[model samples]
Structure formats: structure tokens, C-alpha cells
Target: MPTFTAAAHGGPVKTVLVGRAHNELVYHGDVLNTTARIQAQCNALGSQLLISEVLYQQLEPQPAGQFARRGQLVLRDKA
Candidate 1:
């Protein structure tokens, strides 16, 4: 069985070119870091997909019982 993990967050991010060649596009910011932390929880949670609260709130409302709450997750560097 193949397992997959995903996380989402809606916010501003800083993108810039990095590396010695200055040809690589890198994305950084609190939002990205938070998303990474959320993605890291997938294995432990045994879930195929994980969506952050920020993204969830931005999304259109869904039918009742369409999504289940996974409870709060304490992420690194997050107050």
C-alpha cells in the first residue's frame, strides 16, 4: 500500500534565487515552515492528507461530516 502526505497553508511567502549560480528559486517564510511541519505529521497521524487550519478556513464550506477534525498539533517553532 502506498501512503502519501500533504499539508496546505494560505499566506504570503518570499521567493528568491539562491545558490552559487543564482538560478535556483527558493521559497521561504513562516508559512512555508509551518506547512512543512504539518506535512511531517502525516506519518505519525496515519493520514494520507493533512490540511492546516489556515487553509481549511480559506476553503469553501463543505457538507457536514465531510471532513473530520484531527485535533490540534504542536508544531516546531510554533507558539
Candidate 2:
């Protein structure tokens, strides 16, 4: 098995949805549970570490459509 290094742990999953509050990956007293599903999926996959899209956004945060997806990274060497 290959170990994937995730860089998205403990990041914000904020949204513009009405009647909701800003939320981060780790649950807190005030943060919404927007990232619960994704967190659960990662846990189920045995991925203790995660990459945070919000961290990337720290460079250039977008107004809308800020999203990130994960997949099994395949290594292929062509000789």
C-alpha cells in the first residue's frame, strides 16, 4: 500500500448557503458540520490525514466555486 500525504487537514469548508454558519473540518462549538460527510469518507478509507483546500486558498481565495476532490494517485513510469 502506498501512503498518501494529505495537506488539507483542519481546514475551513465555508459556504454561502443561507441560514448556516461557517464551518471547518474539525468540529467545534460554533462551526457548522459541512465537512462531516467528507471526513467520514476519509475515515472509512483509513486516511487519518487529510489535505485542506482552504490552505491552498490562503494563496488566492476565490469568490465562488472553491472546491477540492481527492483520488488514489497512480504512479506510472514510461520507459
By lDDT, the best candidate is: 1
Give the number of colliding residue pairs in candidate 2.
5
What 10-residue stretch in candidate 1 is worst by lDDT? 1-10
- For each of the candidates, the C-alpha root-mean-square deviation to the true structure, in angstroms, is 1.9, 13.4
Task: Candidate 1: list runs displaced more than 4 Å.
Answer: 19-22
Worst 10 residues of 2 by lDDT: 29-38
| TM-score of candidate 1 to 2 decimals | 0.81
lDDT of candidate 2 over 20-61, digit per residue (tens)? 464433434211332343444564556755444544446565
lDDT of 1 at 37: 90
Q: Residue pairs in steric clash, candidate 2?
A: 7-51, 7-52, 8-50, 8-51, 8-52
